[model samples]
Target: MSKSSHRDPLSDTQLRVKALESVLLEKGVVKQETLDAIIDNYENKVGPHIGASVVAKAWTDPDFKSRLLENASDTLAEMGLSGIEGTHVEVKENTAELHNMVVCTLCSCYPWTLLGLPPTWYKSTPYRARAVRDPRGILAEFGVKMSENVEVRVWDSNAEIRYLVLPIRPAGSEGLGEDELAELVTRDSMIGTAVVEMN
Candidate 1:
């Protein structure tokens, strides 16, 4: 078969980012070493695992969970997990009666320190518009099926604050330790696009 002519949009986006980086370097707007260090930090040093650790702690400790729900920014900062785009964070917990999802309707304002970077879908115009219009449909697309009895709440993130979803602790997780539970928590789950499954 001949190679397809269609190009991947993500590849195109990566190329654009590279071009922008090159232009910035040429203009001396940013140093290559600075860019490299920032990339290294996001790629190797920081990611969703930090948020996963917090979720695991909340799962294991009721007191911490209570505090997290009451005041997310302070609670998260207490663990030294605060930074730009994370200064104001609100956490919503998933329960039997309600499911929480986060979306930046205005733009892709997200908790980068905790969630790494927003997924391309999260930053798309369609997702921003549809998530609020038809959350259940969006959830279904994300492979999350919910009963009619459960309420779906879609929170709009903005410049003032960002949201995180505290996914429900899955069944059969009682035997797991904090570290093990953290492994089960995924970036999508925390974003409310998916849930944590035992498998």
Candidate 2:
């Protein structure tokens, strides 16, 4: 049968998508598990693991945090993690009187090194809409109740650069080391949904 005359099982986009899917499926099958294993391998093993490391380093090393705040790309590369989109990352610190929240108003632009994969809610229309309109209320839903006087500044990550929130370190974590501090920097803390609190 002529190519044009035959029914194509896949369109151009479908062909590309299927090709990637097949590779991922094969990788998972070879690893003797479901696709989730492969995803977990990347999420837990490779992707954004560097970001967690960076957060840890920043927590301990003041010099590194200064460098990261000055220029994220250089600092990240210095730590041997680079090449993701949004190499231009801006770190915003949340203080007691001022809180900062990050959202990709146009799309889900995030610093993957520090944030790993974007959560479903991060990309949802409801979050995108509500984050800008009722940021405090949205944060409240996640159990982060800010003081009435605290100003909430919502940042919209655009095409140029991505954002990572530096949440205020918990009070009791005064003597914590880098490793301990990293554990406190939850994804919610970075996203401004919750604050980092010591138990």
Candidate 3:
């Protein structure tokens, strides 16, 4: 028989689990339960909250915002978030001169450090394809109407650099603290589908 004929017939999920198990077994370092716990801890407790903090700090500190604009990965490390996507991150700012939007296009390649697991819409194939072609129309469907003059530039995230949107700070937040400001920075804002509005 040929080498291909001798291969196993496991499904994709089964193959992934078997591959992970093989690696863990080879390492002989930790139990499956322990590895599961580590994954759970990072996903639930560490990643999203760290990202929120960074957004909050940027809202409150102009200097930090400058640094983030210059070198996002290094600025993120200054806030104790390193090793995210191999120390590489890119910050895209949304402005009237040039609005920025992000979509995985291929898959949900997100910056989990500042924004946890991606939302359902982000992973949808429709969003990936439509976001780049008609950004303003997509945003309008999400109830965001933009001026006709504002140009929208959609970014497709790949294996190398992850993209995050720096939303324009809302008005009437002149006296808000960092924690309060962070609450305004929602996932939609980062995705450039919704703008934060102050009451």
User: lDDT per model, in order?
Assistant: 0.90, 0.77, 0.78
Off by over 4 Å in 3: 1-30
Better of 1 and 2 by TM-score: 1
| Poorest stretch of ten by lDDT in candidate 3 | 45-54
With a 3 Å backbone cut-off (N, CA, C), the pairs that clash in candidate 1 are: none
Top candidate on lDDT is 1
lDDT, candidate 2, 32-124, per-residue tens: 355677677456855444555566677778998888889987877766665565478888778878899989888888777567778889999
Model 3: how large is the Cα RMSD against the reference?
A: 3.6
Model 3 lDDT per residue over 63-120, tens place: 9988999999888887667665526888888777777788888888887767766888
lDDT of 1 by residue, 1-199 (tens): 5433566655678778888988999999999899789889778877899889989999999999999999999998988888878988999999999999999998899898788888799999999999898999988988999889999998988667888899999999999999999999999999998999996
- The list of candidate 2 runs beyond 4 A from truth reads 1-42, 46-49
Error of 3 at 91 (Å): 1.0
Of models 1 and 3, which has the larger lDDT? 1
- Candidate 3: the clashing residue pairs are 51-114
In model 2, the Cα lDDT at residue 13 comes to: 75
Candidate 1, after superposition: displacement of residue 169 in Å? 0.4
**lDDT, residue 129, candidate 1:** 92
